[model samples]
Target: MMHPRLLATSIAVVIWGCGSAEAQTLVLGGRAGLTSATQWLNQPYFGYQRVHGTTAGVAATLELGPYFAVQAEGLYVEKGARYYTSYQMRMSYLEGPLLARLSWPIASSRYRLFALGGMAPSVELRCAGYQTVNNPVVNFFDAPPGTSPLDCDSQRQRHTDRSQVMGGGLAFDRGPSQVTLEFRRTRGSDIAGYDC
Candidate 1:
């Protein structure tokens, strides 16, 4: 597997090249936003709540034409769930998303309505916070109870994840650059280690 850093650099280089000619435009920017993240647990044990966190990233977009574009981003995301207000789990990740986007001008104005959907591959950087232990049935490891402590272990969790990304938003043209307000959701596709 390619290293995450190398993969990010590769994406940037490709985006730069794609934007250099043929009436293409390159838009580079930073992103800072709020995230309400949660995990889906298959077991009927714990009730999960959305955990609030911050998301920040850098994005490179290559506009192929007036209506279509390709975007690549490198982000640090905090994702996890809160368990009954007593415990909050936070898992940090390095994520790379490559998306295909479509945009349309709103009545020939500077405002545009856009929608984007794509796949994002991510690596878990760390896991923190608390794990609630009630009856203590099967732990995250799926081992016999008591064999594994109820603690945050990054290694025990899956290191890599494949996710689906879907979002839509409005964009305002600003000369050579654009300002956008977007709403996006990313969902994990594979079961985490032993649990979903």
Candidate 2:
């Protein structure tokens, strides 16, 4: 969740009073965000807590008009879904998306109300550091977070992989500041296989 204060600031920039045309010609700025994302899983199978983390990164934008622009953003993301009885996992990936942005001006308002949709060729890396765990019971189940010292070590997975991403989001802008809420999905053979 973005803090209320920071949100207010972004909105102020998105709604900056009308600026000189040259000042509007090109916009170079950055953005940071938070997200609640998790693996697609069955709650009945894993009673443990879901994957919870934030994605904060940088972005660059080129405004083509009041209604259209091109955006390129790179975010280090943490994403996963949960399933099975012992679903304990943490993973992270660096994703770069090049997308087309569509925007609209609010009626008689300084802020621009916009919807963004685009395609991103991306990469999903497998974070590493999962250890060979000891199975105490004759009936072997996966490792749990509390089973042993394996709990003390964890790292983001890194590997060679890529995918296609699609997402749509809304943003409010004034001038140099903006607040955006968007959802994007990425899929590749990597998302399906254990090696990815």
Candidate 3:
């Protein structure tokens, strides 16, 4: 007869050993890319244009199998929008994304095509606004009665944002390194102000 506690412990150890043999591989990487961002403002009356910026980050990928993986990234991103000719706003953020990726190789080649979908949560670090004064005298004083000056007054922007990310790109895989190009769209809740 065997002790129940000893039998249970042995069984647990065997299961743990088996699970360890099939553990996912963790790969660490870094990425740098350009981004075009625009604020989805509630006020549609204000025409917003895309603002170009840069994104750089470190990423960790957990390879679950030949076709499936999960990736997480920590990045610094700049986002904002330009309204009309004189007013523009830029905001900086620290962003993190958790993404699920599906990949397939091309006929046993070193190149792979992958698609990723994810959610990114970001914290705003700073926000700034700029305006080009075409005519100082005209802007300083409303010389002509209905014409308004350049509204460069800063507003209190929200400190946090969350966005849904989706995109696909190609990757070239080397021994321990890979080069990838991806285009992703990020849409989300309003960053500031109430809906109009």
Candidate 4:
């Protein structure tokens, strides 16, 4: 029931001069960023609001040539939605993303610009802000007063997600190491048997 929107900034190190005379072919890095999340619900009375979260991860890249490369990352992210001003639906996941990149050097400068697109598959690690109520016969537009708000995890059997990633970045080349700043957007696809 949650579709996430994410913006990330990261820095990576280009590993070079490892007893090779060729250009750098491998990079390793770590990143941490903030996330804003929201969800869509079937109930018309409930209006979802954005909740804040965090993302952290490690990444690796393999250069295929001067202008093309492949990258992979392992990330842990927090996502959810806020409703009713006090109720929050929170979830955490471990994600793996594979991306294809295209890069080119800026004219007469030590900077490179790159664009990337990929897919990330995630497994839910934790979920909260939901409870079962057997009393009063809960239904749409009806709920027991003072009950915990409903979350996607309580309404669905699927605890996994596949998200799409797209972004661009600028890198500063400094000898054997490079520093990169990137902005990315991720959108989650609907999971089977999941509803809110």
In model 3, the runs with Cα more than 4 Å from the true position are 1-23, 42-45, 131-157, 194-196
Compared with the true structure, what per-residue lDDT tens digits does model 4 show for residues 89-165? 68899999888777888997989899998899999998766444445354454343545557665545678988899
- Which residue ranges in model 1 land beyond 4 Å of their true spot? 1-21, 132-150, 154-156
TM-score, one value per model: 0.76, 0.59, 0.74, 0.72
Name the runs in model 4 displaced over 4 angstroms.
1-21, 41-47, 130-152, 192-196
- After TM-score superposition, the amount by which residue 114's alpha carbon in candidate 3 deviates from its true location, in angstroms, is 0.9
User: Which residue ranges in model 2 land beyond 4 Å of their true spot?
Assistant: 1-24, 36-50, 124-134, 137-166, 185-190, 194-196
Candidate 1 local lDDT, 1-196, one digit each (tens): 5689978965664464343367788899998999898776677776578988888999998887677788999999988776664566678889999987778889979999999988899998877665446666665753344343436654245678888899999989899888999999888854356455
Better of 1 and 3 by TM-score: 1
CA lDDT of 119 in candidate 4? Answer: 92
Per-residue C-alpha lDDT of model 2 across residues 57-113, encoded as one tens digit per residue: 678877755766667888777765443433345557776767656677778676665
Error of 2 at 6 (Å): 37
Which pairs clash in the backbone of model 4?
A: none
What local distance difference test score does each model get?
0.78, 0.55, 0.74, 0.74
RMSD of 4: 9.0
Index of the highest-TM-score prediction: 1
